[model samples]
Target: MNTLLKIREFDAHGGPSNVKMGGDGHAQTSTTVGRFVIKSIEKHVSYGKYAAWSGIAWGTDIRIDGGVVMVKFNGSWKKLTDVNAQWGKYKNDQKGVADAVLKYQRTLYPDSPIPTKWLFNDFGHVSVKYFKDINKDRKMNGKEYIMGDFIHTTPTDEAATASRKIFQLAESHGCIHVKPNDIDTMIGNGYLKKGNTIEVHPYTKKAIDASHKRDTAKLPFEVHFYPGIYKIAIYKSI
Candidate 1:
């Protein structure tokens, strides 16, 4: 099946009285791509945050396939929901997933203008690669290959220690999961970064000894993927 995955999201916006008309209401916008639907709307309050109180316009929830690369909204699903505590958390997490998916997709396919269409053209599926650290050049199967930034490294966090954690996270839930061969292309073309540390295990917060250095002799290490759901994508040959 020529399938794509799109995630739905919700967000909120509030500010001072830009408009003091006879009435006040929130403006929400919805979007769709193909069979997939995603909508983002703003909820404005009748009174400012400092005001006694204000009425809220509840947001809607749309379901998107986990495997979809694009979304197509039909303007058919719009419902008012009661404002709740969990809404904020859900909105934040959903947006994170959406943003991460887009960022990773763009990094992987920079030349393609039509992201969804290009992804749908039987280009391939996602593959997860496990590594000891960001600097380590070994693939999961004991082969040497370059690695991409599976997860964004937090500035405060140390890269030399988070490579493994990134690999594991990528293996578990990477959208456009990649394989070792594809990773080779990234390495050959210098798309992969050269220096950084990788976390070995997220659960334990342990780290491997390898650090990113061009000279292999300068840094010596051995690592493996450990065999898991590493990379998730649709392959043309497969």
Candidate 2:
């Protein structure tokens, strides 16, 4: 299964319709992937405005948005979920990061020695860092090591609770949280591995302008790579 993540987006062609077809349903023909623009943003009385990603219910407080997690499985693209493959938030929140990950980071991470008191959501079992916002604008500030953000899914048992929000808190410090099974599916099918080029689209400008920057300086700030051999390929320039 040598499936590669190929993202070739296309613009929608919808005007007066070049021609009409005979059928009970409507259809259009295009030779490329479609990139539809959807503006989803709103302001809160206290917290602020954030781009709400699809599938996540309201009041969840998930900061990740404007991107799709997909994989090529069995000759097709499938939506990849966000969630740590193994550990959930409850187990990973307060000092539950794996030893293998720690050792690997200690040897390769620019900021080696882990602080004794570092207690936050571990970067999950298999995390792939993505280009984070460097300019305080919370938008796509280009692919740079601005934040130690990753496309990770902390394996958790609170999918229903966290997803539906029983007063659910913010998912991660700087990582995108997805369904745990999605992580497994990607890894199992070899859709997510080294050199794979997955795309995370940009957030809306209004969403960006209204977004607030977080202070993750006190914690680890190294971008890209965890213990897993898999790596997310980012080739686009900011």
Candidate 3:
């Protein structure tokens, strides 16, 4: 791994973005893909590979997963969402793949160098033994728990309105989606790169936000959320 960009995903709902997993909209998280490399920054990203489950427009929408994308730096943990930095949402939208991606394509095509199974930048392969890039093939095998889970951008029109650009952000199937410019900036400034570790700290009901005071009583530790730049004040231990 280049440097560990430990992408931690917390469980909370508020402004900006809120993520829920599973078919019932639960935060179904577990030990899954955690580290990998920038497999490819593709333009032609298709979701048809996992369509039977994703049901996210099948082959009609590709740019729905567009934007600049990132590449990394540092060697510490990075929360998928940050108050003062890039915001994110982790969603487990994958059950698994049933067929080859090309099988669903007819009149559709990817952006430039089309990625295998339409997988955009993989962020990096999960460090787990089973999730390893088996067969030494950079492509994810269909048998894997999470395939085609990428950390990239989304279509400008879907997430936001013309007046309030940069929508609060949302979750993309099986992966995490961050603010567009933040992603671009990460890749441009080398804060994010291929071959780095992407540690997805499973989502939980526990969250930290100043906007909600009623829920703090449920937390084991205490976290004070400060507005403005959005800061966190930890009391005792978290």
Candidate that scores best on TM-score: 3
Candidate 1: tens digits of C-alpha lDDT, residues 23-110: 2233211111011100111222223321211122212222334422223223443211113232233444555544544554455444
For residue 140, what is the lDDT in candidate 2? Answer: 45
The 10-residue segment of model 3 with minimum total lDDT is 90-99
| Candidates ranked by lDDT | 3, 2, 1
TM-score of each: 0.17, 0.27, 0.35
- Model 1 vs. true fold: TM: 0.17
| Ranking of all candidate structures by their TM-score, best first | 3, 2, 1
Model 1 lDDT, full chain set:
0.25
What local distance difference test score does each model get?
Answer: 0.25, 0.29, 0.31
Model 2 score (lDDT):
0.29
Per-residue lDDT tens digits for candidate 3, residues 124-203, read 11111113454434455655343344554444312233134545543344444445455454455433444322333223
Backbone clashes, each candidate: 36, 12, 16
Residue range with the least summed lDDT across 10 consecutive positions in model 2:
31-40
Better of 2 and 3 by TM-score: 3
